[model samples]
Target: MPGKFVVSITCAKDDTDKATVGFVVANAAAASDKDTVVFLSTEGTRLSQKGYADDIHEEGFAPLGELMASFAEAGGVIYVCSPCFKKRGLDEDNLVSGAKVVGGAKLVEFMSDGVSSVSY
Candidate 1:
């Protein structure tokens, strides 16, 4: 089987450029036919909320929400950190499409077979 690619994101707002890039990379990996996942931790969990990323448009790139939606639409899995989400008191019922709240074990399971990972 092809190797899986995992992106561990931990940023928010404009400071989340690297995290955004990590999603983009995961999207690219999926486009290349690899299994890809973006694990949102810390502030990155905010992106999993409805309307949170709506107004965030990065210059020279698609809107953050759009990019994220596209990535998920294209089969990129989005895993939001359970503790992070709870710490921020995010509404679990309002999680965006394609996003799931999971514990660290889920992430570890996905990458257990020598999957490659990049942190943002």
Candidate 2:
């Protein structure tokens, strides 16, 4: 793809709004046909675990879990920070759809091609 987009989210239940809207924007990026990635770091790594986002439903928006699923269905990639995941003791076996645990180098590599990025 000619265009690449990155959405960097560092909060999860600690900030439901950011977590939810991040994926909302990710869905938009995916629909726009950009090579989109939602990088979950810090507290956001918890979201990579199955059922972690199931209960997060922001006001006037779809549930976080559904938003995430649809984002993956739209071909969006979800990158969970390896250090953060291990720091939180999150289970790799329970990773949600489209979610992959990766190191900082991976994120840097993806964005090395002059990609656009947003943070929350």
Candidate 3:
């Protein structure tokens, strides 16, 4: 069976370079036909908000918003941390397309099947 891949992102902005890299990897994994999910926790949950990544164009890379949209369109799952988003006072009604607000248990459930994970 194909392996499952989980990407855990915890950054809030373009300055947090690791988050960008993690998203890139997750996109690749999804494209590779692996079961892929991106867990947005802590500051990473900010990306799930509509327009939050709109102007975030990292040098030498695709725009973060475009990258995220492409990943979701390609059948990758985006799970935003519910508590983190709530703590940051984000608007759930304005979530980006293909994003879901879920608790840690949801993430745990997705990764329970011996999934490979990378954290950023």
Best by lDDT: 2
What tens-digit string does per-residue lDDT give for candidate 3 at 1-120? Answer: 367899999996845567678878988998889889999988898989998888877777788888888888989988999999999999999998788999899989988888899999
Task: Report the lDDT tens digits of candidate 2 across residue range 21-59.
Answer: 999999988998999999999999999999989889999
Off by over 4 Å in 1: none
**Candidate 2 residue 54 C-alpha distance from true site, Å:** 0.8
Order the numbered candidates by lDDT, best leading.
Answer: 2, 3, 1
* Preferred candidate (lDDT higher): 1 or 2: 2
Query: Per-model C-alpha lDDT, please?
Result: 0.85, 0.94, 0.87
Q: 2 or 3: which has the higher TM-score? A: 2
Clash tally for model 2: 0
Q: Put down candidate 1 lDDT per residue, 34-96, tens digits, no spaces.
A: 888999999999989989888877676777788888888988888999999999999999988
Model 1 score (lDDT): 0.85
C-alpha lDDT (0 to 100) for residue 14 of candidate 1: 47
CA RMSD for every model?
Answer: 1.4, 1.0, 1.4
Ranking by TM-score: 2, 3, 1
Better of 2 and 3 by lDDT: 2
